[model samples]
Target chain A: MAVITVRQAISDALREEMERDENVFILGEEVGVWGGTYAVTRGFYDQFGEKRVRDTPIAESAIIGAAIGAAMTGLRPVAELMTINFAFSAMDHIVNEAPKLRYMFGGQFKVPMVIRAVGGGGRQLGATHSQTPDAVFAHFPGLKVVAPGTPEDAKGLLKAAIRSDDPVLFIEHATLYQWRGEVPEGDYVVPIGKSKVQRPGDAVTVVSYSKGLQLTMQAADALAKEGINIEVVDLRSLRPLDMDPVIESFKKTNRAVIVEEGWRSYGVGAEVAARLYEEAFDYIDAPIKRVAQKEVPLPYNRTLEQMALPQVADIIKAVKEVL
Target chain B: MKKEEYLELYRQMVLIRRTEERAAELYQQGKIGGFLHLYIGQEAVSTGLVAARQPQDRMITAYRDHGVAINVGLTAKEVMSELLGKATGMSKGKGGSMHMASVEKNFWGGHAIVGAHLPIAAGLALGDQYRGGDGVTICMFGDGATNIGYFHEGLNLSKVWDLPVLWVCENNQYGMGTAVERASAVSEIRQKAEGYGIPNERIEGMDVLEVKKAAEKALAYIREGNGPYFLEIMTYRFRGHSMGDPERYRESEEVDCWQKEDPIGVLHRWIVENKKATEEELKQIIADVEQEVEEAVEFAENSPEPAPEELFADIYAEEV
Candidate 1:
């Protein structure tokens, strides 16, 4: 095992997949010559050549639509949307087209494609640029939604997504690129929908994923120091949400807090809380608390943006409230 | 093309017309649900374009896709079954009028969104290009689709990558109720292709032979690695856009004028004038098509609805 940043882990996964499969190619705006807007594929152009590392026009519909087409034809394409905010431009293809093609066609077509999008807010990019709309994509049935919290999960889950014969929306948190964690050496893949117990504890259950997982982990550490141990469950995949670990952890703790970087309403927290109530209602000791972003358009101001975002303190507060 | 091929083209056009006519009746009877877009007059466009394609070449089109499905070798039974929403349908009853496709026949899909399939067509060509294959992707859409961003992006990418694709736009006068003059910046749809640096042409879609010839030239040009070519086939729909369309946009006189140039009628006249087939043979083809459509309706009616468990099936190729 080697410790690496989330960015490095993702880059490694993409490189390994490309090397392993000849049909795998990368396409998006600034993905080739400009070396990716996020630098996730910085050196891929030079290594893979122009045919595989394609630099597309600034058209999200074309980027995603073409990727879907390519996937339909048996080529595995990893399409990057510069940012998840820009995904709205190609929303029709992402939600209506990609997910519906296989099922609507009665299993005649398979979209073995991965759409890697950078999400979350903290750098003060404003309402249009910053968003954690993971739940929105997860709302669809056919498409698989995977968002990894740590470097290990990022590499493993991304590899699994590429190999799966389904369209996967692989969301990477914008602020967690530098977050470091240990990743296994080679050819390892974590299953897509299974939630993992990041920190085992019995006091209270904390449910989160993506950037929220980072904050929850920090909160868990802080609470542990104060003799309040909380269990952290990282939901690796949002769509095929594996509620087994969550329910199991919740049954043990009897109290729970759901944390997410998105809004409190109609968000991941809402779904998890509802499910927890439905499945493990007998174990409940208190009302499940939810720590999430303020239901407001993320502002450009740094302080205000941070205030809108769910922080480690917010997780701690929610966990304590549930306890 | 052989005399048999000409007769086959004529047979396919008549088959599409008869199938859609029966489908209209079924829709009225409440046997077929959702929207039913007929391809009564514009049969020559898809029939000709599909005939020009090699077996390896791919074809994709918009909602008025029954003609294309028939052209690409889908049986009248398959098309009618899909129309009736049966388990034996082309999309196994999932995709209705606008979603018939056969991977075995290299017909990618029957996409409903206006210009959405254009980029996907480019991607199909790109996949072929990446694999060093010479197969061309022929994507058909209506004139109104040219106004959408997907058309521009798909065309631009096809040229930039020099992908092998034939972008065929069936300029059927109006988009739903609005005419091309009102919906598009330029009425000549091929001019939009010029903006993307792709070679293009406008063709008459009333004559099947003419459409076939133009498609052959365009497909050859793309096959020779000359990049994408756009063909704007000027035609008119003989029926309303969909089953319940209140076509208040045009006059009966205009419709009559275009109806006089009906593609099936034009093909029938051409065959008789050119001595391609006998009057008896032409009559026999029409009779055959009517019988096929009748049998298809019976087959679809008798076919089972998809099993209840099928609702959750094929959502993903693998278990979630």
Candidate 2:
């Protein structure tokens, strides 16, 4: 067993895929010699040359649009957009072109592309860069939105996104890049649109994703100290959400709290909460509780920003309120 | 010039114009549904661009694509059937006017989003060069699409990659009723090519011969591995932007001014004056084209609507 950061896990996935397939290439701003803004592609340029480890202009729409074009003809392109906030520029190509091409053309063409963008709001990056847009992507049927929590799942799901015949929106948390876990050093792929149970308990179920999963685990730990056991379920895939594990956990616990760092209204938490009520309403002992970010623009001050987003204490408070 | 060749271009332009007119009529009837962008007067561009390319080459264009689809070997019957939402249509009635694609005919697609297909065409060119195939890509778009950010992005990539792509901009003077002058700084569409270091020329799009010659020159450069070239065909749209558009942007005199330079009329005049064909012979060809279009309409009307279950079928391909 070996410990690795989420950043290293992504690097391993890209390295393994690039070795596995000659067509798999990486293109983004500062992705090559700069090793990536977050070091996700460290030493990749030396290994893959300039063609595969391509450094592009600071044009998000061009980067994604070119990847869509390249992916359609041939080649499995993993395009990194620095941050998810920048994806607004490429939304037309991503939402209109990549997803609809296969269906619009009656399955004559498929856009095998992966758009990897850093997301979440914890580093005081402020309102512009600190959005969690899981709901926006999850609303689209053709796109598969994945946000993995642990290093192992990140590497596995990313490889899966690279190999998918359909376009996949793979989101990673910028703050979680340096966080570490044990990931096997070999060829492996995790199927998309599936969730995993991070920690199991019988008192209350906690559903979260990306950095939210980390907060859920910490809350589970803190709740364990108070003898209020909680099961933390990491929802790796937001679209085509696997309700089996989520429903099974809800049945075991009969009480649930969804933790998300996005705004409270019409967020991914709202979807999860609605789905839980629809599927396991009869099995629940109390109403579904949701812990999400405050409704205002995220403040830049460290203490205030920390308070704005959901934390372990927030999850604990929500759990106690529901109990 | 041979009478058949001259007549063919005239018939093609006529067919495109008539089909778009009929499409607009159907849009009013609410039969052929969803954004119906017509390519009424810009027929010479599609006919000439397709005529310039060989079978080995590929082509793709923006939403106003009924003309290009018909010119590039898709039967008018197939196009009309698609418009009618019939099961036997191209794309099995899934793609209407905007998303028509025939992979077998090397017709890549009819992308709805403006300037989106430019990079796709460039990539196809790259694939052709890599495979050592004697193929080039003809990417067509409206003048309004020229101002899009993807236009610059695609042109720059094509230049850097030295891809075999000919970016043809149909400068019809309006992008959905916003005049080219209102949206763009330098309304000379050819100058947009200079920004990406790609050579470009302006062609009188009302003449098929002129568009054909310009396309040949652009294709020659692309085929010779000189990277991408640009051709701006100054054209016009006789009708409103779509079926329901009020068309309050331009004056009636502007439409009358462009009608005098109609591509079909120019081709017909050339056929008669150059002694390529007699008046009687030209009328016979026109009659033949009209009959073909009428048959296409009948074929579309008689075709069956796609099954409700088919809505779920074309989302993904399943290997047998």
Candidate 3:
């Protein structure tokens, strides 16, 4: 086992995959020259050289669209957007092209590519920079969405995503780069569409992924000291939303609280809430509490930005409501 | 070009035109659903440009791609069946007129969105470049696509990376109903390529020989690893934008003015005047195309719809 930050874990996974397959290449703005906008690909350019580690112009749509084309051929391309905020420029190429191409072509081709989008607020990069639109991507079918909450899951899930014969929207939370954890060495593969019970308890079930899981974990730890015994189910995958653990957790606890970094209305948490209603209606003891970002364009002001996002206090408040 | 080449080019152009004409007829009969944007006047562009391409080269285009599909050797049966939404269609009836594709033929596929495939084509070129192959990627689009954001982006990357990609803009004059003059500040679509420093030229698409000559020069340049080239094939669509287009965008006299230079007619006249083929030989070429289209329509009509089980299948590659 190797202890590394999420950023290094991502780099390790990419490096390992590139070494394993000559066909795999990484391309994006500053992915080569600047080591990456977030430094996730810090040493990759020197190691992989220019052909494999490409620095593209600041063109989001072309970056993704070109990746799709390359993926459709033989190459396994991992395209990094500077941030998920910029992905809006390539929404059609992402939503319209990548997700549907496989099914639409009647399985003649596979878009075996990973679009790594680093997202979340708190950096105060302003309104456009802090948007968490992973939910928008998950709304479409034929696209696998994986959001890891730990350095371990980050390395494991990314390897799985690169090897899978489908398009994967690998969501990396911007704030989680410094998060350090034990990542297993050599050929660690985490299966997609499955959730893990990070902290098991019987009082209530808490569901979250990516940076939202950070808040959930803090809240769970605080409540545990107070003898609340809240169970934290870290939803590692969003699209093939691993309902098994969720249903199992709900059935055991009979109460639930959902947390997310995106808007509250019709968001990832809302989807989870609806699913629990349909599948495990009788298991719930109270209305599921949801702690999500307030419905407003994230502001430039740091204090207002913090107010817009879900805090650890918000998760605690939501969990208390269910308890 | 050789007589054999001229005849082959003439045959495919006639076949594309007639197939689209039949498709228009079927659209009126409600046999075909969805928007049908017939490439009637633009046959010479696909027929000549694609016919000049090497087998290893990748060819992809936008929604108006039936002509390219046929030119690239995807049978009319496959194209017609796809249009009819049958199980035996090119895309198993999953991708109707807009998204038809065949991987085996090196036709990457057609994208419904304008200018989206341009970048993908660049990606395909990058794939080939990485593999150490000399294959070029031919990305075809309508004139309206030049104004799209990705068009410039895709072109810029192709130039910067020095990838072998040919950007063929079939300037059929109108984007649905809006003409190139109204939608874009620069009337000439080729001017868009200047900012990217890509080698570009404009060709009269009404002459298949001119299109073929231009494609030959561009492909030669790309094969020598000279980077991407752009060719603005000045063409027009003889039909309405779609089957139900009101087409209030341009005057009838304007349509007639371009119609006088109808690509297939002009090609036929050239073949006759240049002694490429006799009148009877050209007539036989048209007859053969009619027969081929007839068989294709029959095949499409007889082809079965996808079974109910097929509806759930192909929705994903594996267990979600």
| Predicted model with the maximum lDDT | 1
Better of 2 and 3 by lDDT: 3
lDDT of 3 at B95: 88
Q: What interface RMSD does candidate 3 have?
A: 1.1
Q: What share of the true interface contacts does candidate 1 keep?
A: 0.81
Q: How well is candidate 3 docked (DockQ)?
A: 0.75
Give lDDT per model, in order: 0.93, 0.84, 0.90
lDDT of 1 at B182: 95
A208-236 per-residue lDDT for model 1 (tens digits): 99999999888988999999999999998
lDDT string for model 3 (B136-244, tens) is 9999998888888888889999999999999999988888899899998888889888888998988889888888889989999999989999999899998898888
CAPRI-style quality class for the chain A–B interface of candidate 3: medium
Which is the winner by DockQ between candidate 2 and candidate 3?
Answer: 3
DockQ of every candidate structure: 0.87, 0.49, 0.75
Ordering by lDDT: 1, 3, 2
| Candidate 2 pairs with clashing backbones | none
- Give the top-scoring candidate (DockQ): 1
